[model samples]
Each structure stands twice: as C-alpha cells, then as structure tokens.
Target: MKQVEIISGGPELLDIVEPLWAKLNEYHKKRSTHFSHKFEQLTFEKRKQNLLKEACDVTINLIVDQTNNAYVGYCICTVNKEKQGEIDSLFIENEYRKYGLGAELINRSITWLENYQAQTIVIGVSEGNEHALDFYQKFGFYKRRYILERE
Candidate 1:
C-alpha cells in the first residue's frame, strides 16, 4: 500500500476539493444517514471558499493522497485565538473508510495547532455520529458540550 501524503490545498485543488465536498454534502443531506441535518445549515460554496482562503494563509487545509497521487481525504484546521484550535471539517471517501486516514488527519491537525502554539484542538461531531465520536475519543477528545436545536 502506498503511503498517504499531505499537500497544501490551493486553486489547483479546487476542482478536486469541490467535488469531494459536494459528495460529502450529499451524504450529509440524506435524511436516513447519520450525518443528515447536522450540517444542512451551512452553505457549501461559501464554506468551501472560506476553507480555501484559510489554507492560503493562517490555517491549513491538508489534502491527503496516495503515493500514486490519487486524492483520498482532507481536513481543515483553523486556529481560534479566543479558544482552542478547531478542526473545521474532515472527510474521507466512503471507499477509504477504516483505513486510518481520519486518524491521520486529526493527528496532523493537532500537530499544526501545537506548532502554532494553540492551547488545544476542538472538533464538533453530530449527536448521532457515534463513529466520529469514537474516533475522536480514541485520540483523547471528549464531549465538552452539547448543542440542541428545535426544528
């Protein structure tokens, strides 16, 4: 198996990132899915550009690829001076799940935050995302708070 490499995201990667983001969004939109209604309030285009901008400067958006250069996953890390650093978003293709890409992304984000002298790192997972919660807990993250909304 080829090692997964991390690359800086930029205009060159928009073509790839946009499609991946869309797919993830679609997955999140499926009402029957665990990710549904969790991120529906967010706008895809605006969020994508914001993430891209963050990568261009202070924050880091890591694009993971195979040694063969095929893209596999990505994560966005943002430093919040008022709080701990934040993992803005993370996504790995369905075919790539259970392969440790998610854990690698979290580790890389934590390293980036520490390098920037951040006090800690924070990530938000939906209430029903047991898999995600488990993944984060495996890395020492705990539920700090709960967010509820009436729909």
Candidate 2:
C-alpha cells in the first residue's frame, strides 16, 4: 500500500484539485437525478469558476499518494462569521475508499474550523448517500435539517 499525505492549502492549488471536484460533481449527479438538470445548466468553465470561488473561501486539503505523487482526494471547509463551520465538499477516489482517508480529511477540516473558533460544524450529505451520511455520523454528525425542492 502506498502512503497517503494530506496537504493543506488554498485556491492556489485549484488546478490540482479541479479533477477531483469534477468527479465529485459527477458522483452526486448520478446519486440524485435532480442534480443532473442543475449540472447541465452550467458550462464547464462556469462550473470551474464556481469551484474556484468555493475553494477561495475555504481551506482546501488534498490527499496525495506519496509514492507516485498523485492527487487522489480533496476536502473544502470554511468558517462563517457566526462561528459555524461548513464542510462544502469531500471526495475520495474509489481506489482509496477503505483506507480512512475520508476520515482524515474530515478531521483536518474540523480542526481548521475549530481553530477559527467555529461553534458548530456541518457537512452537507446528498439525500440518497447513506454511506456518506453514515461515515460522518461515525464522527458525531447527525441530521439537523432537510431540504425539500419543487420545480
């Protein structure tokens, strides 16, 4: 097994992180059909810009394979003026799933937010992603609200 290193940085690392972000978006689109329509409305450049914007506001952490210097996963987190932390995105490549990388990413995000004096931290799990929800729950995150949509 290759060693995985988590590196913390900002939007300056966007180029290296964009591919993972794209994969995450695709994953979500597949898990929830509703997201497909919203995804289709945005051009690639627009999507990239939106991702860049999100990355700019938060701490971006990349999980890399030290042996081969490959980017395999990423997490985005930010703290608001209200002292609340939001984990905007997190994704790990399929090959890396069972290795505790996701938990490490979440721990780093929580630590970063806590450093900012965040009183609460929230991660948004897609409605149908029970695996992700269960993963976060292991770290004490629970359902606090629901979002209903209509079109």
Give the root-mean-square deviation of each candidate in angstroms: 3.6, 2.4
Q: Write candidate 1's Cα lDDT for 18-89 as tens digits.
A: 667776666657632444665676566788667555442244454565556777777767765454677877
lDDT tens digits, residue span 53-112, model 2: 543256889999998999999987876566778888788999998898889998888888
What are the lDDT figures for the candidates, one per model? 0.67, 0.78
TM-score list, all predictions = 0.75, 0.86
Task: Find the 10 residues in a row with the least total lDDT in model 2.
Answer: 47-56
Model 1, residue 92: distance off in Å is 1.0
The reply for model 2, stretches above 4 Å from the true place, is 42-57
